[model samples]
Every structure is written in C-alpha cells, then in structure tokens.
Target chain A: MLRSWRWAAVAAGVAALVSLPTLAGALPTRSSDVTAEELRDLVRASGAVAHEAYGESRVDLPLPDVDALGDVPELLGSTTRTRTAWRTPLDWRVDRLTVAGETDVVRAGALTTTWDSADRSVTRLLGDLPVRLPRADDLTAPVLARRLVATPDTVLSRLPERRVAGRSAPGLRVAPADPAQTLVESVDVWVEPGSGLPLRVEVRADGQRNPVVTAVVLDLELGDPGARRTAFDPPPGSTETTTQAPDVAAEVDRLVPFLLPNVLAGDGRADPAGLGTGGVAVYDRGFEAYAVVPLDRDLGGDLLELAPPGGVFATPLVTVLVGRVERTAYVLVGTVPEQVLRDALTALRRDPPPFVGDR
Target chain B: MILTELAKLVRRPRTWVLVALLCALPTVVAVFVAVQEIAPRPGTGPAFLSAVLDSGTLFPAAALAIVLPLFLPVAVAVVAGESVAGEAQAGTLRYLLLRPVGRTRLLVAKLVSTLAFTLLSVSFVALTAYAVGVALFGSAEVSSVSGTEFSTADATVRIVLTVLYVGWSMLGVASVALFLSTLTDSPLVAALGAVGVLVASTLLVTLEAAAAVQPYLPTRYWLAFIDLYRDPVLTRDLLRGVGLQAVYIGVFLAAAWANFTTKDVTS
Candidate 1:
C-alpha cells in the first residue's frame, strides 16, 4: 500500500507540471493600473499599431444558430484556424473542414484561391481583397480594436494581466460611452501590451453576465512573418474563373432615379441637406455605421431567408433589415438597432438620393 | 540657369492663366456644392469630393483630385511641350545654343522650368481650394473613405503627400511632351500629341480586354494616391505608380536627350 501511494503521488506531480502553463496562463501576472485618459489614448494609438501587426492563429468563433443565420456565404464555421498577414495586398489562409482532408483557402492580393484536396479541384475568386466586418466568428481582434479606437468615450475598467498564446497581455473591460444607444453591454479584450494587438476578445450582450460571443487566439506570432510563398499560389491542374465584385455605387445609382420619390419624403430624419444619397446610404453615429443597399430582388437570397417577409434579423453585433420594394431588394446592415435600420430604409424610400443625377 | 529659365517661364502670361484656371475648378465645385440644394454622394467624382462637401476645409484634396486627371496634366503638357519646341520655332534655340551653355545644360534648364511649372500649378490649385473650401465649408476633421478619421494635421500631411505624388506622376506626361517638343518645332502639335497619348492610355485602361497591357499603361495608376489614406497606408499600388512614373521619366528623358543632342539647330 505504501508503494502504491508513492506511485500515485509521483504520477500526480508529473500531471501538475504538464498542466502548469495552461493553468497559470489565465491567472493575473504583473500589470500596471491605467487611468481612463490613458486607456483612451491607448485605444487611439491601438488603430495605428493593430494595422501594422501581423500573425497567424487558431480562432474559435461564436456562431449563432444556423437555422436562424441562414446561408452565410462568408461563414468560416464555428472554429477556424487562419494564418493572416494584414498588410497591403493582404495574404491569408484558412483551413477548411472537408471529408477527404482539410481544404485550404489562401488569399493573396486580389485573388482568393481555394484548394479542395478531396475533389482535386480548385476555386478562385478575383475581386477586392477578401475582407469582412468583425463579427463574433470572423476577424475579431482588429475589428474590436477599430471599434475601441472609434469609440472616443467608453467606460473602462482594468483587469488582471494574463498570458494569451504564450504572450503576456493585460485585460480591459469597455462599455459604450452612451449605453442607451448601443446593443453591446461591455467588451473585454486581452491586449498584448508590447504590440497593442488584441490577443482575445469577449463581447457581452446587454444585461448578460457571461459573454455572448468570445474569440481567443490559440496561437499567435508577432513581428516579421518572413517569406511565406505557399499562401499566394493556387494548386496545379485547377480551373480558375474570375468574378467581378458588384459595383455597389453603380447599382445604387441605377436604382435611385427609378426609386419612388419621397418613399421617405416627410421624415425629418431623412435630412437631405446633410446626407448625400448614393445607391447606398450610410448612416454613421459614431461606433456604428450602416449602409442601406437597394440591390436586385434576386440578390436577396440569404437575407430574405434569414428574416420573415420584410422582417429584421438581429445578430450580436449587427442588425440586418431585409425587405423588397417592388423589384428592388433592400438590405440595411450596421451595428444600429432594428428600428433605426427600418427608419433609415423608410427615409430612403421617401427621399430621392441627395444628388440623383449629379453622379 | 534653371532659376533663370523658371523666371522666364513664370513671366509668360499663359502660365499664370493656366494656374488661375486650375485654381478656378475647385472654387466652382465649392460654390456649386454650397449653393445647390443637392450634394454628391461620397466616393463619387474625386477621392475626397464627398468629404469636401462635409467639411469645406478638405477642398484642397478635392481640388487635387479635380486637377490630377485633366487640368493639371494638360497644364503640365502645355508648359513641357513649349519647353524646346517654342524656342526652336521662335529661332531662340540657335541663339541660346550659341552661348557658353552646353546643349545638355539648355535642355536641362528647360526641363527644370517645365517641372517647376508643374509643381507651382498643382500647389496653386491645392492652396486656392484650401482657402476657398475653408472660407465656405469651414475646417473639420477629414474622414477617409476607408472609414478612418484623420486629425486636421494628419489630413494636411496626407494632402501634401498626395500633392507630391500627383506632381511626380505628371512627370511622365511632362517627359513625353518634352520628348515630343524635341521632335517638332510646333509647340501646339507637341502639346496635342502628348495630351492625346495620355487620353488614349486612359481609354485603353478602361477596357476589360486590355488587362494584359493595363499594368504597363502610363495612366493605369494615376488615381492610386487614394491608397495613401487607407488605415495602414496601402503602398502596393502607390509604389507601383511611383515606379511606373520613374520608368516613364527615365525612358522619355533619355529619348529627348538622344534626339536633342544629334538634331541640327539651323532654326
């Protein structure tokens, strides 16, 4: 019995040592307390730094219910491991799930090429650099950092210093400067102090103690990425097709003159004097900017399915207003409320674009 | 020699008229926006036009955009085309060459004067637009199309960078005109030919079938100065544009030198 106890004790000691890094990483380390003013400055400075920093990491996204989400073309599943270099003509790779092995998507410059190892086929999309808004599941850190920079006034609280992806980081909990205007209650980010890059981000919905959406960088590397050649090339024997991005401005321009004038005519909110109307009308109210695009009815596939006829779909960070007016399909996307989007849509319908024929 | 040539170039009535005309475009745009009930959508005409509508102070950028594609390049062409050809047509080239000045030095002086005009014309448009825009619109933080807001100081720096880039890009047009000027004694023909080549390049770049040749077109990256306003300051296109301009300057200037040196100066 004494020998058995000795063996058990030895095994337990070994196990504790193996787990130490993971266990201790979450615990608070040495961190200096920061004032609100300093935090604000840090947020401002974060924008310039965030754009300069580049690395690859394993990312776990918070995906809402798929039935409610519908067909999200840019969706990268709930858990994704992507390698990204965020410079001009950005380069990135996402390991996609497939039966015959992991398919890979690499975007270099303006081309996003995907290699399907299972079928031995490759797909290429030639358009603008593949970029998406910071949602719960997609590019989180940069988006969160951008929001922090844009939000001049925020309620900030310092948290314990923690280690993320082997790097020492400090945490800050931020709430909107005007809580009444926003859907987000608080956003907590673990920032790598040396680089001013967010290592992890957790967004809490209004009145929620637990975060509704969280993104943690499983592995991250900062500084020079060296020569990365593979992320830029498409596989051999793969057919490629180039698709042009929809000219949103031109599409809007084409539809604006034909739009029923004063569809939003009487509303004082549709202030013609200040707001120049395009095919897309963007409303910016600090920390939140949304664009109202009136596309063709056929282009409203996923958006229409996500909401009931002319209904709104409220995601954690984005609220999308979808509806059809005659042959034109209108989609309003932003961080604003469902009502605000709807109001803007109404205003758009009533008013002719600020300058209809001037373009 | 360069300073004297520049003074002589500046003394010409047409140079002042060209500068004044370039300056007037932005004033017209400013007045139209201010007086009209309608305003243009953002990201429409020029890079910063929409922003200028928001804050009249951004008129400098709007003016730069207005002038870069046509007015500025044309003004540059007029001066550059007249550099060698006008003197040759007027029989002053032979007299100038008879002096102790080398043919190379005279050519260099003429080129320098033309470049000086390019810089002055661009600067005049930008400064005039700034004044007019500030008078009417009032200065404010300039918002970039890339969704980044810049402080007035940062915006001013970007505007200066943009002006420099525009001036540099115009060197290609100027060099072409200078080369043409060396070929002909008719300043009008040289100017028209240079402007016509630029127009052709612009037209070719707009065609989808011209994709292979698009990268080599002189006008392909003219408007790429907009990339400087991006959050990270996208340098791929800017660098390419600058490199292209540099190549144009080197080749055309060499051609002008080679032709000018060997040509008979009986005129």
Candidate 2:
C-alpha cells in the first residue's frame, strides 16, 4: 500500500511538471501602456505631421531595366506582373498652394509668395515667395517614431538586448527568410533608455549591404503635451463663388478610351454616363479632358476644393472634386493628363448642361 | 444524479459524433493553413486561423448571427432537446423516473448533463484548433492587422479566454432547448421550436424598424464573446454577457420545471 501511494504521488508530480509551461503561458502579460493621444503628441513634438491636408501620396512607374514584364506564378495560378524599378525623382514642381493660418489666405505663383484668401481664389502676389513645403501625408517619420516608443509588447519578445546609435536599446530585428518576400527584409530599431523614444531606425533590403532606408531625429522638443492650435482666414478681395462648372460627359467619353487602357484594366473602365452635373475643364496643348459628378448631399453648403495637377498617378487614376447641391455635398474623381490639361479646356464649346435632379 | 445522466449521455452515438465533428474543424483549418504556408502570397500567412477565430467567435456568441440563425442553433437545439425528450420517446425516461428518482432531481440531472456535454464540445473545438494552429503555423508571434504584435503567452491567454467566452455564449442555446423540450412530446418539435425562436430573433435584429429593440434582445449578447479580443479589455461587456446568460438560463430552467412538473406524461 505504501509503495502504491508513493507511485501515485510520483505520477501526480510528473503531471504537474508537464502542465506548468502551458499554464504559465496561458496567463496574460501586462503591456507597456500608451494611449493614441500620447502617440499623437509624440509625433507633434518630433515635428512629424500626424494628419495633414491631402490624402496618401503615391508614385507609380514601370519597372526600370526589365525588357518584358511576364506572368508570375502565384499560389492560385499565373498572374500578370509589372515591374517599375525607379527611385522617386528628387525634384518636384508645385502646381497649387494653400496655407492655413490665423486668417484664411490664398496664394499662387511660380516662386514662394503668400496670397490673401479674402478673394477666395488663387491671386498673383507681390514680394518674395514663402517657404517651400514638404510633401503631405508621408508615413516614413510616423512609422519610425511608432517603432521607437510603445514598442508593442507583441514584437518586443522577439527582440534581443543590444546597443543602437550609441544608446542602450532593445533590438527587435525581423528578417524574412525568403528573398522573394516583399513585405519587409529586416527592421532594427533602438529605443532610448530614459524616455523610451526610438532614437534610430534601420531597414535593410534583400541584397543590400547598407540599410536601404534610415531615419533618425536631428532634434526633438518634448514641450507642452497638448493639441496644436489651428486657425484659418480668407485673404483680401477673395470672393466665395457659388456657380460651379456644369457637366461635361461628351469630353470625358472622347478622352477615356484613348488614355485609360494603357494605365488601368479590369473594373477600372470608366462609365461615361456616370458623369453628372457640374464639371471642371482643363485645356493643355491639344489633349483635352473634363469630368462631372453629383455632390454628396450631406455637408450642406461649405466645401473645400483643391487642384493638384502635378500629383502622382497610380493605376485607375481618377480626378477628385467636391461640392454641395440641394443641401448635399459629393466628391467626384476623374482623370486628366499631366500635360495638355489647359489646352483640352479650349477644345470644348459652351452648351446646355446635361444632368439634373438628385435621382 | 447528474453524473449518472452525463454517463448515459456519453454512451450515445450522437455525442461521439459531436466530439468527432469538433475534432475535424481544426484539422480542416490546419489543412488550409498548410496550403497557404507552402505557397505564400501577398497578405497571406499563418495568421489565417486567428482571422477565422476572430470572425467565428462573434457569430457563435451571437447565436442569432447569420450562421446560427440558419443552421447551427438548430443543431444545438436538437442535441439539448433530445437530451430528455428523446429518452422519454424511447420509453427510457418513464422507466428511469420510476427508479426511485424524484421529478426535480431528474430535471436537474438532465440540465447538468446537457451543460457538461456542451462544455465538452466547446473545449474540444478550442483544443483541436490550437493544436492544429501550432502544427501548421509555426509558433511565431501573432500580429494584429493594426500592426500590434501579441507574444506566444498573450496569444495563449486570448485563445483560452475566447474559449471560455464562447462556452458562456452556448449556455443560452442550451437553456432554450431545455425549455422547449418540456413543452413538447416529440424531440423533433422541441428542437425545431428552439431553432425557430433563434431564427425569429435574428430576423428581428436585422430589421430597421426593430433596431431599437435589438440591444435588449437576449441574442445581442452573443457576440459579446469578442470582448476578450479588445486590447485593455472591456470588463463591462463580459460581465453583461455573463449576466445575460444567467438570466436566460434561470428563466428557461424555471419554465422547464413549471411545465414538466404539471404536464401529464401519457405518451
């Protein structure tokens, strides 16, 4: 009986040992707490724009050096693949500029200059041009900062203790085992010991010895931890106009077939009939394009409009427009050529508007 | 008494089938994960199980969700409804009730046995899914779509909590089945009636006119199982889910007792 009891006890002890790891693993671990508001403040202090005017910026180009793009085998089947191996051009031209300040203002010029928003439209301004602004909505800086601070506990476990950029930092390195993988090659970030802020970020590409991308802060100011103040004012002599341009479906039909098939395929084929009342016409050299669509009926009367003729074009490129009709506001996007946009407007003759009613 | 009833339940072919079906779900999920792993594509990886779990937990918890309204609740209703009614139909309940067992004790035993079986079914689902997940998708860090990572430890806790939450969710279905079982002589009628209630609640939730009444409906608390996935966690919803389950269980048990005690068992 004594021996049997001892054997039972031994078995129980072994069972407990076997279950320990699983039981421990099933317990939730506390993560470093950081709120979204705190993250927004950190971004502001780092001079990184959190939310800015304009949507996400995209640059699309054909893969450089490749003679012919071929069909690549996917898990499902063969898929057509196009390669564009071009770096972002270092130089860029500004097409239109709008600045928000203590007062609403509008300015237009080839060089840096401030214009009054009172006139409610682009006006030629005298004196030296204002400072050239950086591209809006770039994710590089914000992504780098997020990697530094509040290193999500999920990714923290995979990191090893290491020094980065002369600071004692947690090294959480991720590298895709496969070379063909495009998501990420390797990510290395260094967090400051004192403030938990990321001091340096390095990302290495598949075949590159040196990191293909690196971002480090030149300086940081942890000032008043609060929201930034914003103010808008219109410039002198600027008049708010209610008369929006009428629909131009005929012009859109004439242009889509010639320009679309080369850039976008599949469901991207634009239906010319969808263009409704109120459109803009741009004329450039000889190529012409126009677009018109209904406004969203929700935003009442106020509308913000911007025209960036020199913006990047991805596949299925569409023009964007917003306005209110009958207490409803809508946003319409259409395609226009980079060059010859102005000349296209000259080709269209004035005619009775095409679309009417909310139906 | 409950243990005796539970033992008899385990002997049933249907109970074995439930266990087999529970085991098969993970195997199917594992095969899918293995296929994706062998030939990975953009936005495809081992996290497929997590995505399925995220979506599955909600539908199961909200028994009136699309899937449950159509089929799953009916299946649950059949199992729970037949727990007592089927035995009675087979002439076993009359014999067993005469074997020195009190009426209240028999009802209690039936409810407990049903609850135990349901718990076992849910546990099998959780364990098999986790085992398959670990085998097919290497035990790597779990990354959320929001780019947040969950360590192996955190993932385990989340999975377990999710399982417990789903078990609580099924209690309401079991209770409804028990109540319906007391109402009818035919097990099939009881099962169909329970499923009908579930379907009606689902339809009510979808109607714009009934939108205001949806939150008060017992079915609303079903997807509250997902409260486990919320970072920082919302204890209020979890508590409310449990409270709602308790209410359903109590009401169903009361109705079952009142009806079973008074009804004549001539059939």
Find the candidate with the highest lDDT and give its number: 1
Off by over 4 Å in 2: A1-359, B36-72, B144-147
Determine the iRMS, in angstroms, of model 2: 23.1
TM-score of each: 0.48, 0.43
True lDDT of residue B32, candidate 2 = 61
Question: Would candidate 2 be rated incorrect, acceptable, medium or high by CAPRI criteria?
Answer: incorrect
Clashing pairs in 1: A252-A279, A262-A350, A263-A349, A263-A350, A264-A349, A264-A350, A265-A350
Q: For model 1, how does the per-residue alpha-carbon lDDT over A132-164 read when each residue is reduced to its tens digit? A: 223221444654554554554567777777777
lDDT of 2 by residue, B1-267 (tens): 888888888888988786666567456645764676432232233223324332232212221222223333555677889877887788777787778988778898988887787777766666665555555554544332212345657656766776676666677888888888877767998888877777788688667468556654666666554444433343545676787677667667766776676566755
Candidate 1 lDDT (Cα, 0 to 1): 0.64
Residue A5 miss distance in model 2 (angstroms): 54
CA displacement after TM-score superposition, residue B188 of candidate 1 (Å): 0.9
